[model samples]
Target: MSFKNYAFYDKIMLSKPVTVKGLTFISVVGITIQAYGKYGVFLWSTITPKALIVVDSSGDISFYQISNDTATSELLESITLLFAEE
Candidate 1:
């Protein structure tokens, strides 16, 4: 077999998803979002500045400062820092 075939076979062997320690963040401005997930219908619109939006699996649109936080204080602090710059 060629190198390409060997690589494909290796990927197929590890098709399961694994959890890695990390965080994910998405930022967008002046754009609308439509989210469809296992929860419900969620929508968001950002026509202003400092718009932090999060759409979960339940389809809920909420305005938040920080994206991922371990505690409420952390979230608040992040949000505070976020708008503090702009």
Candidate 2:
């Protein structure tokens, strides 16, 4: 009697789904910044002339209207770090 080869009968398992909630949040914040720059530039500019339109080394543009408010400035810095290229 000859034995049949069962080596080809191995089951393939699919990979688990990855959760990108953090990435999604970052993306949303980035988009919000862009929109604010495009539409709310005038409003913010009037409130704070220290507005910044930064084009990083990667050519990514970000807008920030910073004031004497440390909390707001810190939050903006955190958002910038999030979208920064590694």
Candidate 3:
């Protein structure tokens, strides 16, 4: 998926989302990819959009797109991260 322009804290409504193990995966939220060699990607956001993204050390990604106001979801590719290259 490509990077999308979204307003901070504004949630996105997805019609179709990827389902993994009976769980709907969505929220392809763009993160500020911090470049650090050995440590891998570092993400530190004070405030972000409603959709949440969890990334592990192995570059493994888990998308939690459900918004706080209303539950939500979206579709995403395997370990595909979209953001500004730092």
Candidate 4:
């Protein structure tokens, strides 16, 4: 897989300065998927026009043409199958 952007988070900028050492993974109201590197990719669900937002390591964002949520799942499954078939 390839990435188009990078994202960073800094807690020092906040007054609270929450500290958590080591590798940490947290999912809020949505889902967060980490690729092969130190970057994160999240899926956002919207209502108006059902879209799949892909955020890469360099802060580059991409929207794919997804008909619905089910379509997104199918696409991911298909991709997995493709690799499995190999």
What TM-score fits each model? Answer: 0.22, 0.20, 0.25, 0.25
Off-target runs (Cα >4 Å) in candidate 4 are 1-63, 66-70
lDDT of 3 by residue, 1-86 (tens): 33434333332222335655555544443333333334344333332345555445455667565446434423233222222221
Scored by CA lDDT, what does every candidate get? 0.36, 0.35, 0.41, 0.37
Candidate 3: list runs displaced more than 4 Å: 1-48, 68-86
> RMSDs, each prediction?
20.0, 24.7, 14.8, 18.4
Off by over 4 Å in 1: 1-69
lDDT of each residue in 1-86, candidate 2, tens digit only: 43332232221111222234322111112111111233233221112233344444454656555444435465556546655733
lDDT (10s digit) by residue, model 4, range 15-57: 1122244322221112233323336665333223333445454
Best by lDDT: 3
Worst 10-residue lDDT window, candidate 1: 5-14
Clashes of 3: 1
- What is candidate 1's CA lDDT for residue 85? 68
Model 1 TM-score on a 0 to 1 scale: 0.22
Per-residue lDDT for 3-74 in model 1, tens only? 211111110011122223332223322223344334444444333223344555555655554323134454
